[model samples]
Target: MVDDTGQKQTPNTLEEPLDLNRLSLDEQIYVNMRNDREFQGRLHACDQHLNTILGDVEETVTTIEIDEETYGEMHTSTKWNTSMLFGQEDGFVLVAPSLRVG
Candidate 1:
C-alpha cells in the first residue's frame, strides 16, 4: 500500500492484541511520553518493565503557550536526533509502532 507521501509501504502482519515488545524488535517505533515528548526510532530492545533502547532516534518536544490578550493557545514543536537513547516505562504514555495519529 501507499502511504500519505505516495510511497509504497509494507503492511504490518501483527494481529490484534499485539505484543509491543516483540513487534518492536528491530523495527521503527513511535512512542508518546507524558511530558509532550514523542520519539521515533529503531527499537533495539525493551523489557517487560518498559525500559527501552532506541537507535537513530528522533525526539520531538511540544510546547503550548497561552496568549494573554486573545486567550488562545499556540503550539510549537522542536525536534532533535540522537544516535541512541533509553526510555523508562514510567515515562511512557503510549507505544505502538504501526499506529498513526488519525
Candidate 2:
C-alpha cells in the first residue's frame, strides 16, 4: 500500500493484532496497564493472549491523591526494577519505536 509519503509499505502477514508481539522477541518493549501502572522490559516471551514474560524489567506506579487542605490533586510516581516479570493480558504492549526507555 502507498503511504502518505508516497512510499510503498508492505503489510505484514499477521493474522491477529497480538501477532505483532512476535516481532519484538528479545527486544525492549513497554506495557501500559490499569491503575496508572507501566512496565518497561526486554521481551523474553509472549503468548497468543498477549500474556508475557519479561527480563530486566522496570515497573512504575503513579498514585494520585487530593490534598485535604487545598483540595488540589497531587501526583506521585514510584518506580522499581526486577530481574524478571510476568504480565497478564490485562493491558496494552508496545514494541520498538513506540517503547519508552528512561
Candidate 3:
C-alpha cells in the first residue's frame, strides 16, 4: 500500500505489522525520507556507516547524531542542494535521511 505519495510501500513480513498509526515519529520521518528521490540517494550512500540497523521490508528507523560542525557541513553539502530549494524561511525544519533498504 502507498501512502499519500505515489511511492509503493514495501510488503510487510509476518513479524511486521502493516500499520502506520503504530509507527513512531522517527519511523514516519524515515518513510517520508525514503519516498523522496534525492534523499533516498543520500541514504543509500550513508547506509554503510550506520550500525545496528534494523527493519523489515516495509519500514526501518535508525538513530544517528553528528557533531555540530559535521552537521553544518552536511547541510551545505552538494547532496543537500535539492533540499535547499524548498526554501529556509521556515524555522525548525525537520529532515530525515531516506531508507537504504538492502
* TM-score top scorer: 1
List candidate 1 segments past 4 Å from native: 1-18, 99-102
- Per-model C-alpha lDDT, please? 0.85, 0.79, 0.30
Assess every candidate by TM-score: 0.77, 0.74, 0.16
| CA deviation > 4 Å runs, candidate 3 | 1-84
How does candidate 2 score on lDDT?
A: 0.79
Residue 101, model 2: lDDT of 46
Q: Summarize candidate 1's per-residue lDDT along 70-102 as a digit string, tens digits.
A: 989999999999999999999999887755456
- Model 3 per-residue lDDT tens digits across residues 1-102: 775567667644122332321232124233233322222212211121121122322322343456686563222222322221221212212334344379
Superposition TM-score, candidate 3 onto the true structure: 0.16
Ranking by TM-score: 1, 2, 3
Cα deviation at 81, candidate 3, in Å, is 18
lDDT of 2 by residue, 1-102 (tens): 776688775664354667668767888888888668888898989998778898999999999999999999999999999999988886664433245347
Name the 10 consecutive residues with the lowest summed lDDT in model 2: 92-101
Q: Using lDDT as the measure, what is the rank order of every candidate, best first?
A: 1, 2, 3
Q: In model 2, what is the error at residue 36, expressed in angstroms?
A: 2.0
lDDT of 1 at 9: 57
